[model samples]
Target: MSPAHSVLHAVFGYAQFRGPQEAIIEHVAAGGDALVLMPTGGGKSLCYQVPAIVRQRAGQGVAIVVSPLIALMHDQVGALHEAGVEAAFLNSTLDWQQTLDVERRLARGDITLLYAAPERVVTERFLGLLDDLHARGQLSLFAIDEAHCVSQWGHDFRPEYRQLTVLHQRYAGVPRIALTATADGLTRADIATGLQLQDARQFVSSFDRPNIRYRIEEKKQPLEQLLRFIEREHAGDAGVVYCQSRKRVEELAQGLQDAGVNALPYHAGLPADMRQQHQDRFLREDGVVMVATIAFGMGIDKPDVRFVAHVDMPKNIEGYYQETGRAGRDGLPADAWMVYGLQDVVNQRRMIEGGDAAEEFKAVLRGKLDALLALAEATDCRRVRLLRYFGEESKPCGNCDNCLNPPAVWDGTDAARKLLSTIYRIQQQDAGLTFGLGHLMDVVRGQETDKVRQFGHQQLSTFGLGAPYSEAQLRAVARQLLALGAIGVQRVTTEAGHAFDTLTLTAASRPVLRGEQAVLLREATAQARGKKTRRAGALPVAAADLGPDAQVRFINLKAWRAEVARAHNLPAYVIFHDATLAAIAQQHPQSIAELEGINGMGTKKLEAYGADVLRVVGL
Candidate 1:
């Protein structure tokens, strides 16, 4: 076998290349630079891993992988070690002795892959190591993971990633491959230019993860709805629940656990050891639910996560895609379920506008958030809208909530004008001292409560003009207007020194509130929401399609995987992914010959696991 194919089947457990893997590997191993854009869980690791092994075997030195995710780096090294590949990582988790050992291994050419964070890679000491390797002609390539972070326009912008351009500047001779799971055309171009990979071979794979069914729900009762969805669909499956804040993560995890969901909270505020433990348990155990803020998920390599539930919507498509991609990595059916209320929108908007990021960065963030809003308020298929954002086109998925239960389009022109007018009126009354959503909603919906009475809000011309709409309906219109840029949210400190959110009218508000522009918003009609409940059970529906014998084999395989993983101190999916086991069960192979043909079964895995798999399949 060629080096690529030899390393492919011998180290990694794969019988064939999927999508653009083979071609990309061949090009990179032949000393070509590559810019690969594959979706999350699209087997991106192999493009570099296989090539890294191939080049090393050909007498080239270690491939330097720059990754931002330390936990994920450690996991990748562990998985590679299980495959008997020579890999090590230099991140904060390593002690000085361990770091020196890894550096020594690289120096001796005993390591084929050395993973380091972008921050560590650009340090003076690390640069000296690279200089040494370059002098000896031992450098194989530079692999930049999550390359989009280098782009200012990308959501997860890291300043350290910008310094990575020095890789091309300093080591101009060595080939480089910049890979990312999510990036639009603009972000992609920025990455290419920023990393000096403009002339590299670009491989843009399909962004579709077909096994993941996308679903978005208008939030009515978020925690309750989340509980129902979890109990009904993913009761005993590995999953992730993302919230918008640390406080919310803690509350949601407490609520889920109180409701018997076996959920744990993870955020940056927690002690490092505790956070690491939560992450470790989420990875190692079966059916563990990780409730986290954005801090939790970038590098998670768990493959059997049955679902990713966003209790609060993400800031943008890149974030949403990256977060949701944490699920169903094994190629089984996974659900990307989210519930976004008007409050979620307003909260996210407040974060953007009040944040300390640069103005240009904030503008880009708003555009991305608007794209996410479009997805949330979509009347068309959610999958089509999502794919279109990434510059891909596809027919309606016929599986998303929009396809199964299309939401209603209510003309909110009058409601928007009323709400905008209310923001305008509230500001005028207090000499630009604005009020929050509750007060604004109270004034708009004709509530004669004590606060409304105390503030004399009922005297405003826009007051009670929105009586035709409920508080929820008016809030929805306000949220859409915020997204439309017709209005904005301003963070304020009251006289008592407590901070609060207030609605403010933007320049864009003039055109819409004056009846110059018509407004349309998605309203979750009672019937549509009812139908959504019926259609929301997609996972169970997919799982039940497996035959009885196949189901039994799946159960057996899962049990065996859990036991073996526990014994080896590894994740169950790392032993054998659910999709791989399903394939095994479907094939019902009676011998090692048949097991060798399985997709994830390479020489190392086949040698290490072939017999156990056959036994579980009752062969």
Candidate 2:
């Protein structure tokens, strides 16, 4: 049998190949290594799986998969089993009997794929087993999922991953493939070096997810703002609400529940079963809201999440982008919202600095956080700012809050000068943050404070210089300055408790002369546009590629997707990812090969419904 036919028939029970899957499988089966950076809902799994099947058919041993998350390993194994593929995982969660059984299966050449943690693969026992498998010619290739974790500098670093390089030295002949959904240019280089995959062919897909509408709101009455947002944008959609603290997650979840929302809390602090229960409910139930800390969504495969709301600011822009990317996997419309405040920035900075990470790493993290701050305080297009951070140029998406409700601009140069001078005079010897902008503005407006009198700050010429504005307007100006790099927020919550603090001037803010009259200017430049809304390579498809029947089938598949999405309370793609439906439409297959030609149609799926798809297209 041909390698392609054998691959479809033996492990996956399909007759054709999917988008880029055939080429990737062909390359890997021929012993070439690869690096695939596809979107979350993209069929990254099949790129390795099909090749593993082909290798096994060619008398190779089991394909070794290095996965970071133990739960993700179990999920892959379950899916493989349903497809009739021989796969098993060895991890800390496995019992002694299960471990022995997996080892025995590997020795007998009964398993085509063996998934293990990077930690376990380097162990003496696993090495010995691997040696035996190699002797019997049972070893196929090494597939590394979430390969970005190998970088100690990455957000999801795993020190154990460094040991994976040993797999190359020990098993020199076997090919390898590394895959991940998220990585910046720096992180991408780091991963290639860290994993010693310098020679691997890289497959970098576009990072844009136009289905998700990016939105950020200033944390003014955050709770009320969140309530209004939820009511308007996602009244009955399944979504995730992310909080920075476990306590806040619980509180917000309970509050949402009390207010008649179907919300549940999930975090690492909770018991394992409870967390699992919440996750399972989120995956299975329609319209369930999972209120969670950052711990909840890593390696999670839920695709149809309609909204991702951040109750607090994320640590960095990368973290925010990755977290929000989880929504709208099926190429459907979704929302990404956050309520941010200055305190959130201060707290996150402290957290990053106080951690055991190196100073250089902290500096990198700080720059990323500052970029996110710019997005929040930006009066321009939210989508434009978000895309620009990822190195993509975009026009302003006129749909976001700032675009719809443009902030009124007033000449605040003189006002900013006054605040800067007051801050400089009060904390002359000591540079610190005294209070929130409102209270500071109150003091500046000549409102008597016993503390101000004790310090005698009301006597300064800058004090009460700009009393025409309300406290809110003053606070807004201070925030704008901070965003514009005209002022620096003092890192208030130090190792010491909040006894006394005040805003300090930075070199960036020193240029605003206190008494100089300033002009009010608002200019929207190179306007950020709405997301580039199109299917993957939509423009590249030939006019002849989609015929009348194919077009009809595509519409029907989308209809089915929408129905399933509504019924399952999932984002449409979570039910049947866009790539999968698109593949079905593109290949009006009359037989299994034509069906299998579409990516993501593994053996089990093809065996079960290959004829159904062909029949639907009346082929």
Tell me, by lDDT, which candidate is best.
Answer: 1
Q: TM-score of model 1 relative to the true fold?
A: 0.92
lDDT of every predicted structure (CA atoms): 0.85, 0.72
- Model 2 earns a TM-score of 0.80
In model 1, the clashing pairs are: none
State the lDDT at 82 in candidate 2: 55
Index of the highest-TM-score prediction: 1
lDDT: worst 10-residue window of model 1: 530-539
**Model 2, range 1-619, lDDT digits (tens) per residue?**
7676566665554456545666777788889888877766566787888888788877887899988777678667766765678899999888999889988888889998889888888899889998888777678999999887887656678899888888788887889999987777778888889878888888776666777777775576765666666665566667899998999988888888887778999988999989877887787655788999988776777666778999898876767877888887656667888887766765665566567878898778767777887787776877788777766788776766677667555677766777777777767733444665655676678787776677666777777877876665566667666655566555456566753334556766756654443434332222234333333213212122567777677767666656645654444434445456766787666777767656557666667556666666663
Off by over 4 Å in 2: 1-26, 353-357, 394-411, 429-438, 484-486, 489-502, 512-603, 606-619
lDDT of 1 by residue, 1-619 (tens): 7778878876776767888999999999999999999988888888999889889988988899999997888778878877878899998888899888988988998999999999999999999999999899899999999898899888788999999988999989899999999899889999999999889989999888888889887788888988888877777777999987899999999999999888999999999999989988998876789999988888778877889999888889998998888888767778999988878888888899888999988988899999999888788998898899999999998888778877778899998888888887777778656677888888888898998888898898887888888777787787778778887888888789988887788899999978999888777565223223323212223245578888788778878888888887777666766667778877889999988877777787888888888888883
